[model samples]
Target: MSISKKTWLLIIAFFCVYVFWGSTFLWNKMAVKELPPFFLASIRFTSAGLLVFAISIATRKSLAITRKQLLNCTLAGFLFLAYGNGVFVWALKWVDTGFASLLASLQPLIILLMMRVIQRKKLQWKSMVGVTLGIIGMYLLVSQKDIISKEGMVIGILMILSCLIAWCSGSLFVAKADLPKNFFVATAYQMIAAGVILVIASLCFQEPWKSPLVWQDNTQIAIICLILFGSIAAFTSFNYLLKHVSPEKVTTSSFVNPVIAILLGWYFLEESISLQTGIAALLLLTGVYFINSRKRDKPVVVAKTKV
Candidate 1:
């Protein structure tokens, strides 16, 4: 039997999230090589935001929202995009894209720990074990003498860690915050807010801005891919999958994205992958699996990371 139109759409949507979102690490790394990170991010998000609005209007999604919702959207945007994603792109300048992706995959572990501390929720046995494995994995990943000895490695790692915090915190906040009923509208507002703030940040940091026309060909392609596929297509697909499929199935992207990043980095960028890093990937991903598996029965608020 032939596949239904909806089934075809689902397959395409999954492809977008898996490959588009996964390859974003490489794209960001490539772009940041030629462009100032904050300035690059400002342009990417600003252009994507405008495009998202245009799409929303074409689709006739309501653009209306209360003041409180707008404020919450702004806050979410600041936490998730301005700090979380902007600094993440900046850190890419120093860190290998594969390693950066692995570190970002720790969002579930971070969120769980945050829940334990902020909500005082006792961890179940599976969760406790998952947390333990996650910690070990993180230590192994970071404790590699060869990797950490490089100039600016420590700062890159620290900045990425901070991004995780901001992203996880944003996830927690959005779970409770009053926002526009339409996710697309809220996301549009958040993107615009993040774009504006990143522009100010680029200025405050004295990051010399260059016109897109003058950017290197590869950098231009990278930025275009980030705006079109990474930000817009992947995000739209993610929301689509969440609505049509189980959340757990959609979350499988967390595992797939890093693997894709690692492979792409190795093949295209020639990024090294050591024995320790391999082991760490195994442990960390397994831990994330356990955490997610355990949470299926007794659900808690979980927010996905965009990077």
Candidate 2:
């Protein structure tokens, strides 16, 4: 692809991840209101995984993999979706969607540190400064929000941070791991493995079989949106970006995702954004600018650690 075409594709993918994943926070918040977190997450992951897996097979991609590949996908699935996302869904029980995403903005920072430690990569001063500003922006964003309960807020923050660590670790692993060459095939395995595990956890904890279905129109819509946009569209775009760009740059969408989530919350749920939100928005956006527009040429080449 020409540089210009690649740039436009990256831009489009970034926007998809930013908007759709941001909206997933709301989808999650709505679904959690009516169903158990693990149960809802299990359904979403399974459906999305199966859908993608079938697509891959129909498109003539190999579903067959070596044991090592399966192990890699399983480990990544556990970390990325099961622990990272499943626990995140559980955290949504106590945290608001916007607030959860604000906490998630910490991923870029976690990724920065983890890559430096695990991969022995050196960070640029400019990138470090951008990460610091993003952290400060998150603090400001959370500080101005309406406190739900001090106890619940603290619990939710801790839970989200735990998943943030797992997510960052999983992302770094994916950057280096030898999985299938086809991106969709790799993602399909991850989702399928994670989905199966989550379903088991749901049965153990939620026991949905013991209860009647509590499906509602709004909840169903949210779930469908999550499966289609959040899981299929945004996640595929995310993995695509991962293949072509730096993880740091791929995750720049985290900054934008929170901004979108806050706005959606305000529009749909009437969640208020204070003046701090506006100021924080500027800081966050500027931080992403610095991260994405770093002086490095060919950041993807430097940032990637091939296995």
Local distance difference test, each candidate: 0.90, 0.76
Per-model TM-score on C-alpha atoms = 0.97, 0.84
After aligning candidate 1 to the native by TM-score, how far in Å is the CA of 275 from where it should be?
1.0
* Over 4 Å off, model 1: 297-304
Error of 1 at 79 (Å): 0.6
How far out, in Å, is residue 201 in model 2?
A: 1.8
RMSD of 2: 4.5
In candidate 1, what are the lDDT values of residues 1-307, reduced to their tens digit? Answer: 9999999999999999999989999999999999998999999889999999999999999999888998898899989998999999999989999999999989899998998899888888889888999999999999999999999999999999999999999998998899988888889999999999999999999999898889999999999999999999999898898889988788888889999999999999999999999999999999888887785554543443756
